[model samples]
Target: MRLIIAIVSAISRGLGVIAALCLLSAVLSVSEMVFVRYVLGHSTIWQTEFTTYAIVAATFLGAPWVLIQRGHVNVDILQLAAGPRLRIAMEVLAALFSLLFVGLLAYAGWVHYEEAWSNNWTSETVWAVPLWMPLLPMPVGTIMLALQYVAEIMRLFVEPDAEDGASRNTLFSDTAEGTRP
Candidate 1:
């Protein structure tokens, strides 16, 4: 169980890094587009589409990292006010619901990706990027999120003292909550 959690956390952390890179690449591409359109007096082809896809990809791929970090915006007032048992219960219920939602999303995304890949879909632009390239992250990231949710559920029971698989400083592992590695 520990090994499984550790491996999933490692994968989530890796996805976080990749997502950050995607965001950074998007930013750079947008800048390049502006430079080409204004400074070089030329029209851009792929940069606009690339930026959109990269941003979307980052959002999807970064979800597991966000979940582990507890970075998604939520009203934690109830959590702060509840007793330990109630808190655990609430957290468990929430995790289960989240797991269900992400699981369905993953299935749908996989189906969509399969169709795209099978049809060899491409963008209707001059760049004509393969649709599957961007679509790949949807199912992949959501599945990772689902696995991370399981790890989170386990952490609640198997490691009660741990802090929700969250690290304030790092993108991976719960190093800040006095939990054993």
Candidate 2:
């Protein structure tokens, strides 16, 4: 279990770097499209669709790391006001819920990927994206998400403060102090 969690965390972090690059690529593509359309008076259909997929890829790829790092925004007003033990209990419940939800998503995505594979589906767009391309990311991302939550739950028990000072927590701290954008 420890080895598995370590591997998952490493892979999640690597994917996050890829996702960052994809996000930059997506931004550049959109900027190019805008320049072409507004300044050059023409835009390629592929550029728009490709950019959209890049953004999606970036989002999916980054999701695991975000979850691992506990970067999701949480409504903690009530939890914050509650006692430490209550807050810990709430976090555990939330992590369990996340695990269940992501487990379902991963299973569904696997089924979808299998069907797509059997049918040899492809995108209807002129660029012809293989259906597996999008579907592959779904299961991969959701599984990563589930693993991260599992790791978090484990950390809550085994390594308290593993999630302390997480990225979102920092953001929330800034917001609480009226220093956030």
RMSD of each: 6.8, 8.2
lDDT score for candidate 2 against the true structure: 0.77
lDDT on C-alpha atoms for all candidate structures: 0.86, 0.77
**Candidate number with greatest TM-score:** 1
Give per-model TM-scores: 0.87, 0.78
Off by over 4 Å in 1: 160-181
> Residue 93 of model 2: what lDDT?
91
The list of candidate 2 runs beyond 4 A from truth reads 1-4, 35-43, 162-181
Give the TM-score (vs. native) of candidate 2: 0.78
Candidate 2, residues 1-181: lDDT per residue as tens digits?
Answer: 5666778889899989988998899889888888989999985677787787788778877898997776887888987886445566788898898789889988998999999889999889888878887678788888888888877766655543443433333322334432334
Error of 2 at 17 (Å): 1.0
- Residue pair clashes in candidate 2: none
Model 1 error, position 166 (Å) = 17
